[model samples]
Target: MRTLKKVGFSLISIILFALLSYVVLDFLVPKSNSSSSENEEIAQQQSRVFLDLVAVGDSLTEGVGDSTQRGGYVPLVADMLRTNPNVKNVQTANYGHAGDTSSQLMNLLEENEEAQADLKEANIITLTVGGNDLIRNFRQVGLNGSVEDFETTIQEYEENLNSIFSLLNQYNDEASIYIYGLYNPYHYYFAEFEGLQAVFDLWNERTVEIAENTDNVTFVEIDSLFNPSDAPTETEVESNSGDSLEDIQDTNHPYLFEDDLFHPNDSGYKVMASALREAIEKELEDTDSLLSMNR
Candidate 1:
């Protein structure tokens, strides 16, 4: 009887010890995970930096064709910036005027105190100009015009762009400027007009060159997002799934334009916002990496 009692006691002791160990491990493991998560959150918060955005440009920047009417890419970008756990706050000022040319925008920048103040305080600036400039010429002469015809106009636009950059730098040299390149809305319509493509390509190339030459300037290329493959032939575009130009204007393919077949719809604006966001994130990453290396 004593031997049996001893055996029973040993078994009970082993079971109790095992249970106690499991209970202790369960409690400690969760605490360790919680502590690790808290540390990560704290580190992320510490790494976050505040952003101030200033948007200036033409009708596109003004959010003209967006059915949501939510201030186009401006609000979208602000929302994205807010999504970052690290971004403590995002302040935005938009001076996007409908039908404003580059010269007109420059005038506004020089004359408007509010815009100048915004630029001075901005950590990032976005521009969408030069489209109306070319569009006006196209409307006047149609595809019959040659690239050489716009030389003077292009030169003047370049000068205005330089002045715009100079003014922005003067207001805040540290602010990163993102300039959107022009996308040919009429590419499908004027596919046969080879000069049209040449002119648009030349304009984009010049815009890129200008951005590269300027400090803290990034040219956001949106042309490809609209024209995914090569410029579709007129027949191909016309026969695009049997949809009319008006029907396909907002159809998410071949035509990202609004009903007007010019301005971007809400979906199109989102794409623009995405591109801008990516560029901003990349710039921030590069800056962080440089700082870390220095440290």
Candidate 2:
């Protein structure tokens, strides 16, 4: 009878301890969740200010895929930014061309009346123009009938790229210029261009080195964001709705292109948008922390 009494006491003690533990955890959990909410609040508080973004490049920057703010990455990024009270009223300027090479882009930059006006108000710029340069170089190589053609093309590319960066920096001394690394779109679909991925890497590495020497400049890479499955099988929306890429035009140009299949599809644009969104958030977070430290 005495042993039974001891057993009953032991059981009661165990039950009491468990109840205490459960009560303590219940109290702590809400506070733990609130910490995350607090962090988001801080981020929101910092985002009330909007930064102006100016983008220059080929078709990718032009919103050829899903139609930009109406559709593609830039608009999505801007929308996301606005959600964080820290970022409000973001505007983007698109300076993109369908068949623009680096030299052509340089000419366009020199002639842009809007860019001149933009110099006064632009705070951020993103660039993704060099891919066309690679295409033109490769085309010239094919026409010239020698591998040596690539070397000359690269030399020209180097000079033009340097000048473009300097020009962008010159126009916007206070702006943060984010340049995108070239994507190997050829390798993305065609089986023959496997080695070109290395070429693209080398090109991106060079751009990174160039950006490293400059201040308030960063190079974003979208190659990693893409997968074979992410590529869109559909054509880009045309200038006129009826003139789509579904009809075969020529060997150099196919119906799969609004201008060219070389440009990204709507799916590709979404991928670009996703990558840009991540970049913007990370960058803003870092900037907010820096501002706090300064305070």
Q: Please state every model's RMSD to the true fold in angstroms.
A: 7.2, 11.3
- Candidate 1, residue 224: Cα displacement in angstroms equals 0.8
lDDT of 2 by residue, 111-169 (tens): 89897567546766777777777777776554323444465666677788788877877
What is the C-alpha lDDT profile of model 1 across 236-272, one tens digit per residue?
Answer: 8567678775665544344455357678878789889
- CA shift at 56, candidate 1, in angstroms? 0.5
- The best candidate in terms of TM-score: 1
Error of 2 at 88 (Å): 1.9
In candidate 1 the C-alpha lDDT for residue 63 amounts to 89
**Candidate 1 Cα outliers beyond 4 Å, as residue runs:** 1-40, 230-234, 237-257, 287-295
| Reference-based TM-score of each model | 0.80, 0.67
